[model samples]
Target chain A: MIEVNDLTKYYGQKRAISNVSFKVKKGEILGMLGPNAAGKTTAMRILTCYMPPTAGSATVGGYDIFDQSMQVRRITGYLPENPPLYTELTVKDYLMFVAKIKGVEKDKTKAEIDTVIEKASIGEVRNRVIGKLSKGFKQRVGLAQCLLNNPQVVILDEPTVGLDPKQIIEIRELIKNLKGDHTVILSSHILPEVEQTCERVVIISEGEVVAEDTPENLTARMKGGERVLLELEGDEKQVKEVFRTFPDVTAVKVNKTAGGLLKVEVESKKDLRKDYAQALIVKKIGLLEMQSDKVTLEDIFLHLTTKEEAA
Target chain B: MRKTLAIFEKEFKSFFYSPLAYVIIAIFTLITGYLFYNLLSWFVEQSFMMTMQAQQYRQAPPKFNVNLHLIRGYFGTLAFISLFILPTITMRLFAEEKKQGTLELLYTTPITELQVVTGKYLAGLALYIVLLIPTMFFMALLFIYGDPEFLPVLSGYIGLILLGSTFIALGLFISTLTENQIIAAIGGFALSLLLWIIGWGATFTGGTLKPVLEYLSILVHFEDFAQGVIDSTHVAYYLIFTIFGLYLSLKSIESVKWRT
Candidate 1:
């Protein structure tokens, strides 16, 4: 439901984001994965029509953000990094105010607010002043404001950043439930959160898109080779020599751990578990344990974001 | 227009929700009441002195226009008092939104910048009118005890509203430039004071320069309204001044979208 092309934003001479491009399919939950200062918020602001892009174009729900910003704003709900809440207003009042400005029908404004309040699970604190509420409740109110008018696209920036672990999970669940009905573009630096919640992720680094794919596909592409860790009772030198002799073995390192155990790490072009077992049997070495190292989403993110800096 | 009213309703309600609004209104009433009482007592004393002189001379005292001494004098002090009061009313209009980051919510809505500015400006003007409500009772006191011309009193109120609108528009424009409400208040006060006294420059110069400076002084046009003279030129001047202030505010708010 959102399309961005060559989106660039400059605050004075400093480039906040440069030539960024991405798209979110209808009803798809897209995660923008980036570290701090990666231009995620800037890109989201442009899409929400909070600010126009300096040198590119974006359209939301088929309305150009620059020319048809009113139509775009009508269909899009944005929760800025700070939540954009009035501390003096109570939760219900704030949401009702948002609903009004979002142009909800007057007859249905209260019902719409109640629906979002229930969705964000902030019903208990609905009457309390926002300034007095806890951070989690306040964040929920922010989410509640975004869901008003049943917006087609919800753009949230780091919705779970300052929450506790349990609150984080609750927020992630809330976002997950939004899928298949609302087009969500959430930005975060947390890899596992995105991996668990988003169907697709656009990995941004230093104001550029370094990678974009599903979590599994990204991990698969970065897996590169098979790696295994083995614990064996043998001479460390002998263990290294045995693993290195295999033609498929690209590299091998053996270290002697405490309790007279030799720890061996091996990287190979292909799975060498069979070859290692045969070699251990011929050498009469006791194989205590063996397991392959599976590449994780964290590893993939680090590889993609850090590799750009190193280059 | 509906979006503008939504904004206006929220803004107007926000004023009542905060203690600052009540404090400002109370302080305004006390100050204006005290000034009115003092002006009335002084006028009574002057008239008493004139009657004593006439008795001693065995002749009639000169006629004293009650409207000129009491009603016009009270309005003059009120105009001065508003220099301090109006800034407090407008200091938080746009500045608080910027400080609290709520401007993001405002800008992202389907409303134009003009609508937002106009909505806020009207809210401030409405509150100023509400603040002036108590002064009507003070005026009613004049009608019961003395005969004051109705036209001048009505014209003076119109002037006060126009003057308040002008100050509010300027304050709104200044508020958009800063996130600090205190700075906005102080900046607004400084600008209003400058505009209030610009006519003083007319005394130091002659010919073209004097009229140009006089034309810019808000107090100069306000005098015509205070005297029961319904000059269309003065009305047009205040309207144009208000329009100019709103235009500046609109431009400043729009610039924030680009610069931020």
Candidate 2:
């Protein structure tokens, strides 16, 4: 439900984001992956109508961000990187104030506040002053304010940054559940978190989109076919000699495990597990375990960002 | 309008929740009250001396009513003093929020920048009026101890309130122009004091330039209301000043999002 075209933002002489463009479909969970100063927050701010782009335009729910900002704001909810909260106000009061400003009806504001409090699972600490709450609760209160108006699009920047492991899981599951009801665009440096929560991933670096695809597709793209992990009991020199003789084993990395078991990461041009196993058996090098090491999202993120920097 | 009112209510209530508003009001009232008492005592002593001199010389003395003149002088002095105090009250309204990042959430809502500026201005005005409450008892003392002209005293207070509101608007505008609260407060104080000093320059110019300078001087217009005249021109001037200041605040906030 959001379309961004040639979006560029400059701070004085420095270009924060240059010629960035992307689209997020309705009901899709799109993750923006980037390092610090990668223009992720800038792009999200432009989409939420909190800031205007220096160049080009964006449309949310069919309304231009600059021209019809009020309409765009009506349908979009934003949680900034720092979780823009008023420390002096209580969580309940803060959410109530957000609901009022978000233009929820006066009669429905209380009910909406309760709904969001429950959704963010912050009902117990609702009356506590926000400044005194723990970081996880503070983050939840920020998320709760964003959900107050029931906007069509919810944009969260580093939503799980300061949370504990348990809170992180809960927040991820909550975001995953918001997929169909609200188009979610979240930015994060944590690659696996995005891989688990988002249906599509867009990796940005140096103010440009480096890669975009589903997590599976991006990992596959990075892998370029097949890879494998193997453990063999043999002398280091003998393991290297046997690996060199094996056909289609493109790359081999050997590690010595406990009790001198040799663990090796073997790259290949195709699936050759059966052939490799036979080669090890005939050579009398005991094959203990063998499995494919699938390329992960972290590997894809690191590879793409590092490659972009190198280029 | 409903959303704007909601913002106004919350902002107004927040002043009570924090110690900043209470401290500012208490300090303002204490200083103003002390100044009021000292000024009244001086006026009364001057009047008695003039009356005694008239009896000694066997001539009609000047009709020196201490309470009436003190009320007029009270408002005139308030106009000058509010220059420094109102800025302290309003300097943090927008600047502190921008500094701490809460402005982002407010901007992302469906409300217009005008509504946000107006809401903040209203909140500042409400606190200012509350701060003026203690000064009213000084007037009660005026009524009991001397012959105080009721309408003139009321008009002078109206002038003080209007003048204070105008400064709050100017301070709010300056606050929106920066993220540093101290810088905002300093900028606001400088601008309002400059406006207050504009009256002194009117005396330096001669001929036709004098009237033009006088018309621009806030003190020139405010003096009429402070003396209980209730001049329509002065009333219009304060109202227009408030609107102009609020307009600039709105533009400042809008430019922030536009330039982002």
Candidate 3:
């Protein structure tokens, strides 16, 4: 549960974030989608009470970031862009120290650490020195550190960056596992990662929120038209003539591919692949391949983030 | 108290996680031991020379006061040695945490700023104590063969610890100003050296400024403690100095959060 209202921050002459506002419902996984320097980290830092906002207010778990920052911090767990780690300390020692400062019960500190260590899958490396571990393990250790104190709100900044593909999948799964209990707000530049992991997406660009919706709703909202590709083994002259029978096809372009096949690209406002396929079948033409292209998440992101610049 | 001790435990233990702690302690012990040995041998040689002169002239030689000539002399050297060594312990206290980004962890947690500062300051004091332990052993050797006034020697230690606590406060404040360890060390040393010698200005200027400078000079107040006099004024001065340094450090840290 978090609420941010008209948050703005200025580092001297330069404005880092301006009039940024967002909210996370209890137990909801919210994705902060943006490119680098999109002020996502700045927004998260303000929420965590790491720094005060220049001209706005925010509350975490009903405790204001300014007036009751200690209470706000008690319920919030934050993993900064770089995992704040002591390279010399062992994993267990570091976790113990975090638990102590997080105000966990003295008798339960170990058990609580074990719980997060198991949750983040860092048990194997718990005894090893943290600095000697791999990047993925270090990131998991960071997650484990955030999980201490049984915090209700977990704010992670680019948790999957700089990891291998397999590690990325593992971390995404781990974050997904936090659902139903912890309200997660993760920031990332990766669109598909946000789409797959978050229940609600807030797309931010240039320090402002450009769009916010569910993945499917965002896709539907950004999907303006459709493009289809059809490859047929028939006469080029007949292919050019076949377009006349379809009244729905707004435009068509024919490309002559090698091996005597015609590549026909059809543009229309509706789905017409079945209609065209049947037409080709009735004409006794060999339908070799057909694939339709819908608007992808990347296109929507780029459009939303860049349209203001162009305007 | 729980939060303070948690931070104190971590900060104190982390020092030994590197070779630097062992090296600093060993080097300090060796240098002080060598200096103590030279002072003792010179004292013994001087006493023997006085006895020979008394036998030759049949008159009494000047009394060779062990507390004045030997233990006090060793303490004088130790006070300056601590000036050089104590800042190195404190220079890393806040600066390293800021550099490693661990201050974010502390700031974002439930711990208070006072708890964090006290934890770190205590760690620096602990290291100074450990550095002084072997010199205590060196002083125990004095009790084995000669009779030095035990209270004066103990008071001399009180002086050094007070002096060290003051230096740590000043150094901790300097450490809070920057993220660079080298700059923290050098800046802390330069400022501390300035405070240690501030009394010298009293000779050049006469009037209110002279007493003010003398009162402010950390070295001048330490003279009472080194002379085995636990004057409450000197104790109050060191305490106030220490508190002011801690207060400045707390403000610097708060400024970092607010300003940035």
Clashing pairs in 2: none
Q: Give the top-scoring candidate (DockQ).
A: 3
Candidate 2 segments whose C-alpha is farther than 4 A from its true place: A230-233, A254-263, A274-278, A286-291, B47-63, B207-209
Model 2's chain B yields a TM-score of 0.92
Q: Give the TM-score of candidate 1.
A: 0.95
lDDT (C-alpha) at residue A2 in model 1: 91
What is the C-alpha lDDT profile of model 3 across A51-138, one tens digit per residue?
Answer: 9999989989999999999999999999998899988899999999999999999999989999999999988888998889999999
| Poorly placed runs, candidate 1 (over 4 Å) | A230-234, A254-263, A273-291
Task: Report the number of the highest-lDDT candidate.
Answer: 1
Q: Write the per-residue lDDT of candidate 2 for residues A1-311, one digit (tens) a residue.
A: 88989999988888889888889999999999998889999999889988888898889989999999999999998999998998888998899889888899889988999999999999999999999999999999999988888999999999999899999999999999898999999999998899999999989998899888899899878887578888889888888888788677788889998888998888888888888888789889999899987889988888888998899
Q: Write the per-residue lDDT of candidate 1 for residues B1-260, one digit (tens) a residue.
A: 88788788888989988998899899999999998889889999999999899989999886888888788878888899998999998899999999999999999987789988999999999999999999988999988988888999999999999999999999899899999999999999999999999999999999899999999999999887888887888888888888998999999989888784
Error of 3 at A116 (Å): 0.7
Per-candidate DockQ vs. reference:
0.69, 0.67, 0.81
RMSD of each: 2.0, 2.4, 2.2
